[model samples]
Target: MRQSTTTIMDSQVNILKYNQYFLPVNLKVAKTATTLNAKGILPAGTIIDATGKVVNDGTAFGIVYENVDFNNSMGTENVSVLIFGFVDASKLPTAPADAAKAALNMIKFM
Candidate 1:
């Protein structure tokens, strides 16, 4: 009988998102998450692209989802959710044209 071995390598920072795991610039699910409900990774210091005027990559500017301040009731219901994800500083409409690069302007909803 003969034995074989396989190896996988990665350099991207680990992140969690999309009910799946990803390694920055990559959206493939990890082998261990085959049966898990959510298994994804997001690279730190990374942003999702939102400037279609500049590029059409889904991996654009940083995107995130968060629910801060539960005081504001959308339907008279007292409920709140946490926040997550990444965004770029420029993509933010409120962000000045010359805004710094260390900021997020996009978001995702959970």
Candidate 2:
């Protein structure tokens, strides 16, 4: 038998500027040197590449839709990525680089 556990956390503020449209992609998050939040979770709005590695460069693929704590039994975890939507940049953990912003053309950062 196999078992899995999932923890649900709420965001204080909505990162999406509007509900017009948002695309969610399931991806296996890769372990990286990127710093985690106080809760040891990769916060929502954190940018990542197609390989699921945290990045702030032009290689950015999409934004995380929820907090993810992959430092557990499993070395990697599947997470939801927002490929398209209007996001409030101010709510992001860090400001995305110009190259990254340009790469995510479908995502509009307010």
Candidate 3:
């Protein structure tokens, strides 16, 4: 995923659409990337991590997601980031300057 794609403070978190491994908004959620032939779905109110990480709460039923990112091809170099933590809307770091901007913009809308 391209870092710094959006601008939202604490709101630019990405969703794990389909089944692509992605960084969790927070670090408490469990994330896993899968390679499926068709679009997958996740149940609403699934309590996903800030970074779109799904928590392993003893659930196995996958919900049907409608977003387009989930269907992204998952093959060689299809790796995605996963993270979870206390989200900060105004704290921007330098290591991921791109993501910092994207996240700030995203939070602005939230």
* Top TM-score prediction, candidate number: 2
lDDT of 2 by residue, 22-77 (tens): 88899887656455667768888899888877899999999998887764635677
RMSD each, Å: 16.8, 2.7, 15.2
With candidate 2 superimposed using the best TM-score fit, by how many Å does residue 102's alpha carbon deviate from the native? 0.8
| lDDT (Cα, tens digit) per residue for candidate 1, span 19-80 | 34222222322223222112222223323233211111343343222111212213221111
User: Order the candidates by lDDT, highest first — what do you get?
Assistant: 2, 3, 1
TM-score of 1: 0.19
- The lDDT, on a scale of 0 to 1, for candidate 3 is 0.29
lDDT per model vs. reference: 0.27, 0.83, 0.29
Q: In model 3, which runs have C-alpha deviations exceeding 4 angstroms?
A: 1-39, 56-69, 72-110
Q: Which sections of candidate 2 miss by over 4 Å?
A: 1-13, 32-35
Model 3 CA lDDT for position 13 = 29
Better of 2 and 3 by lDDT: 2
Decoy 2 TM-score against native: 0.81
State the weakest 10-residue window (summed lDDT) of model 3: 59-68
For residues 9-37, write the lDDT of model 3, one tens digit per residue. 22232333323432222222122443222
